[model samples]
Target: MPRRCTRNRRLVLVVLFVAALFVPALANAEPAVWVVKGPHATVYLFGTIHALQKDDPWRSPKIDAAIQQSQTLWLEIPNVDDSASMQPLIMQLGMDQAHPLSTKLTPDQLAKLTRAANSVGLPGGEAMFESFKPWLAALTLSIAPLMQAGYDPSTGVEMELKPEFVKANKPVKGFETAEQQMRYFADMPEKTQIDFLSSELDDFDSAIEKFKQMLAAWSAGDVDALDKLNNADFRDKYPELFQILVVKRNQKFTTQIEDLLKGDSVSFVAIGAGHLVGKDGVPAMLEKQGYKVTRE
Candidate 1:
């Protein structure tokens, strides 16, 4: 089991919420808001957490100002509120009715998964676990603890911002469709998926503590700490998964940012904070393309 699994699960499932209180900019600070200047446009790239606790501090005057100034809101996907549409897609991509999930794991792995599942009060029995792909099962198991801890995806940054954007009559766009995002995991090599599941099951408890640390670092705008927690072990142990999930997506989004920069309008782009840190992160990739990304 790779140590990267839990962090990867956190990156995928959790939405990050930054503190509403703005901290004064300092040297080497990695504020959640980054401003980039194009010849005729200004784009604010905001790193977001996908889910948050109900009481998480997420109101910031600076963030509010950015939202007000922007004409368009870009997210990893649009219509996040439409879970009805997303459910079918997730089912189509993540179900493995052709084979039982038990067949893919060893006895030890199965035992660990069951223990973790029960600990989190996951609703499904073995039948439910057997019906899912390893990646899907892993994701379900990973999120259970967070859910138990009172984090709600519906209360995430995207969900919170979408209605405001709509009420303001701003157009919301997506970098990728829901189906495409689902396939990133669905198309993984079976061995990798199994390894990911096993790793997550093995480290379920520690993963919760690590998630807390991640949230704290994110709230404080500690890019170095966030990068270390999110990317360090994952990059070293699972280069291929890292490439597919983070690097490739960053490349594509960077190209889109360049295109957006060519226009005159201001756009606010929100994506998972995991995609905003490290050498292969969106900010770094944009910098490599000669864009000056400054913390706002």
Candidate 2:
């Protein structure tokens, strides 16, 4: 072949080869949970599913009561709706067209997202998604259906924990700021993001399938099932990412919890359910340190 033709052939082969290597990692990840314990305080390690179908049972009067009795609220990030509270930070974190997420994919791959969004019956059709960031798009893909069903983020143990605490003027704090949480999206290399978004794009059917099994486990209070689903392997390999995302953040809240006990104030820390379960879970870490956690 001519030199120019040979170079073009090699380029096409390289692109195809790279793509083949990426697609399978997309299919295997699962999310789940486990529980842990500590002294002087109770940390309920609940594994949370960002999305769930309408009919799973995970009512915890214990958790409700725990929130009511606790002195503060701790979370993975400051609440998303608390935009005014974190506006400057959020602005600094925004992504733009020069960094345009879609540019990372072929036109065909992008079109698949359109079909995926439509398949799940998302609102305003195409207009609903305009000007949205890829991370927000991923967030929307993960949670909307569960919202559409009966799972209310607003009604979850965390949301309910807020109003009552605020009524008492209790302090609500986040381990990380809004910019930090949102960066989990912005920091992804373009291809990894495409992988993230693509998994979410046409994700409803698979999400629905997983929801069924997830619900069964949640209803049964099968913490191990939740842990298995959360995929401990992914957590193991990505220790640094996991630390930034969950563990190190959990450590910040632990200090606050320790301080609370000193004041005779029983504080309720509501974090992502996943944070409380497993060997790496807060409760386990605390138990190792001698805090007694009683699961209800």
Candidate with top lDDT is: 1
Q: Write the per-residue lDDT of candidate 2 for residues 163-236, one digit (tens) a residue.
A: 76778888777666555656655676655555556655654556655655655555565557755555364366
How does each model score on TM-score? 0.88, 0.67
Once superposed on the true structure, which residue ranges of model 2 sit more than 4 Å away at CA?
A: 1-61, 77-92, 123-132, 202-204, 232-244, 251-263, 288-290
Model 1: how far residue 279 lies from native, Å = 0.6
In angstroms, the error of model 1 at 237 is 1.8
Cα-based lDDT at residue 150, candidate 2: 52
- TM-score quality measure for candidate 1: 0.88
lDDT of each: 0.75, 0.50
Candidate 2 local lDDT, residue 14: 20
C-alpha RMSD for every candidate:
6.7, 12.4
- Candidate 1 lDDT over 168-278, as tens digits, reads 899999988877877777899999888778767876888778787777677778888889887787788778877887889899999999999999999999888888888
